[model samples]
Target: MDHKAKHILIVGGGYVGLYTGLRLQRALRRELKSGSVRITVIDPQSYMTYQPFLPEAAAGNLSPRHVVTPLRRVLSKVRIRNGKVTKVHHANRSVTFEPNAGPSEEIEYDVIVMAAGSISRTLPIPGLADAAIGFKSVGEAIALRNRVLALLDRADSTDDEEVRRRALTFVVVGAGFAGVEALAELEDMARDAVKYYDRLSEKDLRWVLVEASDRILPEVGPEMGRWTLEELRERGIEVKMKTLLKSCEGGHVVLSDGDAFESATIVWTAGVKPSPVVNAGDLPLDERGRIMTTTKLTVSGTNGAFAAGDVAGVPDVTNPGQYCAPNAQHAVRQAKVLADNIVRHLQDRPLREYRHKYAGSVAGLGLHKGVANVYGVKLHGLPAWFMHRTYHLSRVPTVNRKVRVVADWTLALFFKRETVSLGEIESPRDDFRAAAATG
Candidate 1:
């Protein structure tokens, strides 16, 4: 093989991008050091969020800072570009890169990996874009925590019945794992927080969950899903099945089932679609807008190009006629195979096919409450909750982050969860601007 220098560009710094870059830097250390190979990772943010911990971060079970791993620190050997890939001209072996500031430029690469993950899937429900918040990133999680606590404060300070009722009512849309865990965790936090307020109690708060489908947590199978539904209902949470949010204009929520109410807090965790960046390239894509890839993790019909994780429709060889589910389990495992295949391709060696059997799912409902179906064994309540924490803790990226998360969890055991609102952080210049106007 020629010893000419080669540049490998990885788009998006999420699970696949980070892990693949980390592995490539390690696997090709000599080549990298000798200037024979180079790797660059680009994303809007400089860190990779450990998404499974987002709910816990919102609930104060984990620190927000610990929920993300800095890409630069993790991929030290690779170049990190904190920006966006506006367009990919694969036919010309280059992409249009837009940095956080300044003009956009085109970057040429010998090989490209499309790991730009998915975004929150939303609908055209009335007032959704303005009134509802998503539960995807760390910023959203922190903002949600602050919003809930702020609303609680408002409810306690006011004597108006209608205002208090609106402030205390919380509505969460969708019933998937993200929705269930978020609702459960936030409810637990709010219930504990009410103890500190003289005029507020658990009874004053109303938590409602709406699902267009008949069941929630469908990933855990029907039996476990039923158990979760009953558990939420027993806790005084209104679980509306086969119902849709027809409108939520200006905090007034209307349902498809003809129910209407006023709520100050509305959370949307319905679903996710492939990142729009996938559409900016001439790559072969499936009907669902995901980049198409073979079992070996290489982009279909494209040389020196690859894709994995939520953005790629990787065929599941273990299950005939099915593509791998877009989840952390598949994404993490696929990263390993993707990195190896890239190296194998470089060395002119036969690439290994990516295949992994489906493992069961685990989700934390709240503190000491969860459900799990690993392999064929099923668990519920406390045992499953322990498994949920244990499994995710083991998967968190770095030793530094893992230790910090464990420390946060350890402190929570002996102390009460913090319930303070820092909503002002979202708009830090507001107070300064007000002072300037007064002067």
Candidate 2:
């Protein structure tokens, strides 16, 4: 609060923003408590979600609440603001935030960290926006979880094959880490859900994976992609590659590969683009609309301004051919350097640069099935799946959340996944109407 205190304002509460804020608090514990420095984190969401666990959350393997780390409770030293930044006048060293339930408020800062992160990168496919749902965000994940369970319920009560097929047919477009893992996990669960319904059978349901490229899971290389295709095909899951979504109006998936399927569930996880917030203020953006930053994590042409993670187009000094891809792998590594350079700026020390090798990618395909490549070491089957859980559990923020997550896994070892779909929570209106009518 003091005039001389260096105020560090972080513009997001995601992988980079949350980690950086917490790191700063730990590193400057004495300074922050003494009011020598003030840290502020501005984000619309009150929590930072562990995105790698999203598939499990959607598949009922993990609770949504458990995966998200509350910003205030964890980063107790930082002042948390719940609002969207409508305008960022970085030139004036101030930003305007539009509260969720109130008018906009402005705050000034000595240093700003642009970590607004990426949004669901959508395409212009016809009727896709209305017909297809994205697989990001806690809301979207919970909604998809409900939709999946509800589809099973609808199928159980109906005798019509037409309706049954539509309800059971789940189409996932895009075979990236998100799309592939989602389809694999959800299908595994749906197949399990049908066991409780006498009317529904595993064979009756159809799962389709439509990818724009010839290979799925492009991050693990073509051979691994081919291996995944074979695995999917063996599971009786339709794997259509090099196909484009021509139209998906009314849940009818029309593809370029001469296939048209009727489905009630359509998930779009094709790609992601930087959020519009990158261009919201006066921040410099690259062609992809990502905030452009130097190797030292400093925003180009700005002294106290820096950025990293998905929203930042941080130069990939390790790879000359491209910038760092938008993934947690790069984001976490970037946060370490970003935090160091920020301290460097404070003490007039030379700023350290961010240079990380893409340590390969990992994907979980439900239980006992996964694909991973680390430092050119390829792993699959149960080993990859176990490694996947171990890696993420270790990376998930905070000791409290880590213990709970590990307990969730330990219990999973003794019992099957929870089938109870808290689907009603997705739409409280149903219960509200029931209560009103009963009253």
Winning candidate number (lDDT): 1
| lDDT of each residue in 65-99, candidate 1, tens digit only | 99999999899998999889989999999999999
Q: Over 4 Å off in model 2, which ranges? A: 434-439
Candidate 1 regions exceeding 4 Å error are 1-3
- The lDDT of model 2 is 0.87
> Which tens-of-lDDT digit does each residue in 1-439 have in candidate 2?
6798999999999999999998888888998988999999999989999999999888877878889999999999999998888777989999988878887888898899988888888888888999999988878887888888888898888888899889889999999999999999998888888898887788988899988887899898877778878888888999988899999998888999789879998999999888778877898888878887899999998878999998898888888858988899888888888988888899899998888888887789987899888788888888888889988998999999988887877787798877666777766799789999999
Q: What local distance difference test score does each model get?
A: 0.93, 0.87
In model 2, the Cα lDDT at residue 221 comes to 84
Error of 2 at 88 (Å): 1.6
The local distance difference test score of model 1 is 0.93
> Once model 1 is optimally superposed onto the true structure by TM-score, how far is the C-alpha of residue 335 displaced, in angstroms?
0.3
